[model samples]
Structures are given as C-alpha cells and as structure tokens.
Target: MDFSDLNEALASESYDQIGEICDNLMLQAASEGVPFQDEWPYAVHLLGHIYVNDINSARFLWKKIPSGLKSSQPEISAAWKICQKLWTKDYGGVHESLREFDWSSQSQGIIIAFSERYRKRMFELLVSAYSTISIRDATVFLGMNEDDAINYAAVGGWTVEPNSGMLTVKKAAVAVEQKVDPGKLQRLTEYVFHLEH
Candidate 1:
C-alpha cells in the first residue's frame, strides 16, 4: 500500500476514501504472514471505529487481536483501552487517557480524522447525562470555546438558550411499532424492489 495516497487523502479531507486505503493496507499486511510488529493495522481499524461510531465492531476487533501484541504494542493497546471505555460509556476515562497518550504517527490517516468526532461524542454524553448544562461546562468538557460549544450543541439538535447560555436536551420519545396493511404489503412483495425518493 502506498503511504503517499493516505497522505493525499488526508490533505484533501477525503475521509471515506481513507477507510478504503486503511482496509487495503491491513489486508496486505496480514497476508504477508509475518508477525504483526507494526501498529498500523490496529490504528487504522480503531480509527475506522471512531469515524463511524461503531463501538461494537471495534470491540470485536479488539477481542480478535493476537494475544502477544495486546500488551506489547503501545498504540494498539491504547486504542483497545479507548474502545473498552467507549463500550462501557466511560467518557471521563477516555478523555483522560487520550490526553496522556499521543498517537502521532496515526494522525495523517486516523487520529486527525476522529478528533472532532470524539469531542462531539463527549458533548453528546454530557448532554444526555444532564437535564441542562451551561455552555461553559460543555466547553471545558469538550475542549471547545463557548461559541464553538454553542454551535456544536445547535448542530447536534440540542436546544441552546441564549439568555442563560444553557443547552437542554429533550428526552427522546419511545418508538411505537405500527402494523402494516397486509394487502398493501402483499402487493409490494409481488413486485421487484422499487426505489423511494
């Protein structure tokens, strides 16, 4: 796999394209049949998790990692720890550990790709936990400025009151299952799939 393409994709901010490159690199590395001495595969896969917000997939990958490298590889180990914390909803631990450790080499492809997403996730967790929180508290937790925090909240579909600088999250409504009309369903099933606009 060419590292140059990864760098170009990062420079162009083509994140989805980067996932393809990461997957190809990982597959190529694994097919070589050598002991995994490099942290590249783990870094790419974990970042794939961060980009897509699929903790379950990340957990599965972590569990499948070779036992010898689980403790020996620093970056991979850290990524696993982060995934574990994410699985447990331990945002505080995730934040602290990310602060203490550096995943610099993975920056061009993965680390930079997921930085903002991670902050937004922390913001989401905070909003879900509290009925209402000040923009100040949110800024500190998410490591963003007041204006950015408010903007983030707004983009996240949260209610931010300008008067008091507080963001409020409305409790989500429960989903109700509705039964489909049997006649309509039968008619639809009789035909080939139709694309809905």
Candidate 2:
C-alpha cells in the first residue's frame, strides 16, 4: 500500500487518472481475495468520478460499494447525495450537499475543485442560453451571494440593471469554420482518379 501513485495523481489534480488508479487497486485487491486495509480511498475514487462530471460512472461506483462501508463512512454517503442531486439537475441541492459535508483532507481538494468547475460550467450555460435573468436565479445557480453573483456577472461582461435587479447576459458568438486537410484532399483526388480509370 505505497499509495505513491495515488498521491501523485492527487497532487497533479488529474481526477480521471485518480479514478483509474482506484479502479485498478480495487480490481487487484479483489483478484487477490483481500479487502482494502484503508477503505477511505474509495470515497476519493467516487469523488473523482463526480469531479469529472461522470455521473454514470459515479452511479456504478456507488452501486458497487459494499453496504457496510456505505453505512459506516459518512463521506461516501455525502458524495452519493451530491451524485443524486446532480443526476436530478438540482443545482441548488448539489451546492448544499457539497457545503454540508465535513470532508476529510483527502476529499476536500476535489470537492472544492468540483464546486468551482460546476459553477463555471453553469455560468457558461447561462451566458449561452439566456438574454436576461434575475439576480436571485444567478445566485442559486452559482451558489454565491447577490453581491458575489453580480460581481461574477460583471466580470463575464454582463450588465446589471440596479433598479430592476436583473442581469443582462451577453450571449457568446458561435464560431463555425470549415477547413479541409491537404492530405485528405489529395487522397480524395487519388480515389476519384482510380474510380474514373
């Protein structure tokens, strides 16, 4: 149980790699007919999947966990709660779940990372989808206070109407460009010549 690989993966914040390492470790342990000496890593493994927004894998991992371990460790349950909230598209619940959990040191970093990533993604979605939204809805979506949400919106180049408490979202422009590769074009010409002959 050296855990050097796990430590390195965590240090690099390669969450998908962290999930892979945990998956391999579990498989090896099961093949050897032994249980993990320290079961805490499973919590991190579950969180890693969630951090990457791989809800399907997270659900599978949750189902694979032993019932005793699920009951014994609150962290696992907390992670599952977040998973459930995410699965249901409950943004407010997801933030609340993250805030309510008293995470261990190993799990804390990923939790914070997940929160920021999710918030930024939601903000991007809002900027793309909405021309106008209320401050209250933005706060819930970003898990921030009114002031913070306003500031965040400002940073994103959105305008705030002080009298109406509304944010005027700036929709991002779509860039669609078509470029043909020279190699592919040459290959297509060669194929056409062969067909004609």
Candidate 2 segments exceeding 4 Å error: 37-40, 176-197
Cα misplacement distance, residue 10 of candidate 2 (Å): 1.0
**Residue 167 miss distance in model 1 (angstroms):** 5.9
Predicted candidate 1 versus true structure: per-residue lDDT over 1-197, tens digit per residue: 44677677667776656656666666676798644445446655665665676777677677767777677767777777777776776655666656666775655445555666688667767756887898887876776678887887778777889898788865545699999999999888766455442
Model 2 RMSD in Å is 6.5
Question: Looking at model 2, which ten-residue stretch has the lowest summed lDDT?
Answer: 33-42
Candidate 2 structure quality by residue, lDDT tens digits, 61-165: 888888888888889899999999999999989989999989998888888888999999999989977999999999999988999999999999999999998
User: What CA RMSD would you report for each candidate?
Assistant: 8.7, 6.5
- What's the lDDT for all of these models? 0.68, 0.87
Model 1 is weakest, by summed lDDT over 10 consecutive residues, at 34-43
Note the clash tally of each candidate. Answer: 0, 0
Clashing pairs in 1: none
